[model samples]
Target: MRDPFAPDFFETPVAPEPPAPVEPVQPVPSFPHRPARSMAAAMLAAGLVVGSVAGGAVGAVLVSHRNTGTSPNAVATVAPGVGAPAASPGSFAAIYQQAKNGVVTINASTSSGGPRSFSQAEGSGIVVDTQGDILTNAHVISGANQIRVTFSDGRTTTGQVKGVDQSADLAVVKVSVSADQLHPLPLGNSDSLQVGDTALAIGSPFGLQGSFTAGIISGLNRGTTAPNGRALTGMIQTDAPINPGNSGGALLDGRGQLIGVNDSIQSPVEGNVGVGFAIPVNRAASLLPSLEKGVAIQHPWLGISGQTLTASTADQLGLSEKSGVLVVQVVPGGPSAKAGLRADGQASANDDVITAIDGHSITTIEELTQYLDTKNVGDRVTLSVTRNGQHISIGVTLGNFQAQPSATP
Candidate 1:
């Protein structure tokens, strides 16, 4: 063998130290690489499977809860922005206070043949002025020898008759109360009053002094017949509580102004039936200034009983083309008779139907009276009538019914 270093051919290339044991290099990792389509499909399938089960369970619970009962939050409640509705008592109280002061309790006694004879009646009156003048119903003081008025302040005084309008059921009385205690209530315009307006009545009903009641205006321009067969025109109807002694009291508006004078009540029971009538203050006031000045009042009278022209009557009288009043009957020597106006006499002839007075169209007796009211007692008026299928005009001078005194007391 050769040298030991040169060993054998098998171990020959052992390799020169194996090339110094070449170092192996390691590769770097990238972001977790995945197949995008495959991952997305798997996630979608999982979501569908979870959503189906959860949705069904939630629907079941909602249905069960709905069938059980209403939720606590479902109850109704008033809103903070709203308030309850009510009426104001201030208006009513103020009107009552102002009107009651003008109201006075009236008591009258009529004498028979003997000194022991006594017939007493109680009523209410309104103070018209500081001069001690008072207004009451004519029937209250009718045939009375002595009359007394009691104020709310407990002052009583003897009353003297100034004058009486039997037709209107109004009378004026005079008392000697001081001016300090004589505050007259402000009068309002009743003609402008509407239905359903608030009304207040103050009086001494049943001798209960300073009694007050409240209501609303139920009607207007109502026609009422007196017990003596006299017709009261232009009456105001109300539902205010009125009793026996409320007559001649004051009917006031919400503003504490006098609107009317309480005159009558329609009741079948012992208490109020809510049907009451009053004379409009405007109508009554028109006559007040004259009476206060001691001027005699002369009421104009048409002197004929008539009625509203109904459709049937309108057709029968050939008034199909017109609307007017039909004169039923005429009194002898009355104003209409003196004016040569023909009425339904023994001869059944269709006299001319009155269609208008001056320029006003006559419809009801109330309408006719209202037209007549526009003129004075001695004033002359022209009536437009539909007669014999022709229109004719007639001039008439009104007569004073009050001027004719009753032959009997």
Candidate 2:
């Protein structure tokens, strides 16, 4: 396990700044549940830099900080597809057999070779349409000179880039496979999924063709980093052992519905550590049209990175609400900056509190960005903030956020 003291992570817009030390506030029991998160950061399991990728090696990209702590359970491993298929069609065996046909192995290569004369990377994708439209992680095919998608039936076809939404770290690739050859995985309503629900992961983990793993939805609305150093919001957290090549694979529910896209794995060694994350299918479904249109998809950006405001932290700062996000840094010329938002103050006495958005109470930085997802670039919204003791409303038009600060957000 990496030191919990180390740092790297989700780009709330720009990368996060180290949180200031806070005086402990009394824990308010009735308040929303906010887990104490380590300020530590890690790289996405598959988002290696272009240079490292040029060597045909997979470097870490997503940050996985939490170690579920040791338990007294006996060690045991279950073989895939051991359960009764008829009783639970959504069983591990059923989901694997039913979905593996739609799951495709993606091999990407570039002639700009380094160690390997031809740099190559392998990942997974899901067939989303009969017309050859498939979905995978953007980083999987990032910078590929050629893409080849192979199905369980051993049918291979040239893959064309449809479009990539780097903010979500998702890409749609189109192939010329016949409709009969394509078995589209049904996209499930992620909103219906809850913690403890069955989650089946299918993809090419570590280039192993047609692999399957079963686990439960460990968490929801989880936040993680994308390939482009941006924050991916509302991610699904699972205990399934997703590995390096599992990026862009299918994270399905027991019913064999594609609920999430397997993307981030929790590992210090770029392997599986039992925890992994997936982009919710709802997020992918929302951006599918724009992706298919070959247009850039824009997720709203406030351009400032801050820490989650804990109830204890909020009370320690003398804030009224038991919940709210503390503003630590406001990027110059960002929507919040232009609206005159203040960064962390000389001490905790001065940190600006983002209390609400349009009236929706915000308690975490994830909630803030998730709310922004409902809006678009150029859409104006009123922000309710508490600076010092006074409450103020600031109207700001959100700006479109790309990779990094190329002239503000």
Cand. 2 TM to true fold: 0.74
In candidate 1, how many Å is residue 376 off?
1.2
The estimated TM-scores of all candidates read: 0.70, 0.74
| Candidate with maximal TM-score | 2
Tens digit per residue, CA lDDT, model 2, 306-358 = 66787778777777656677777677777888988887633275777788999
Off by over 4 Å in 1: 1-91, 115-117, 225-230, 267-271, 314-322, 345-352, 388-390, 402-409
Taken over the whole model, the C-alpha lDDT of each candidate is: 0.60, 0.65
Measured over all alpha carbons after superposition, the RMSD of each candidate to the real structure, in angstroms, is: 43.2, 13.7
Cα deviation at 213, candidate 2, in Å, is 0.8
- What residue runs in model 2 are displaced by over 4 Å at the alpha carbon? 1-91, 113-118, 311-323, 344-349, 405-409
Model 1, 269-385: lDDT tens digits are: 334566677888777766665554445666677666666777776666555434567766666787777886776652223665678888877766678876776677778888887
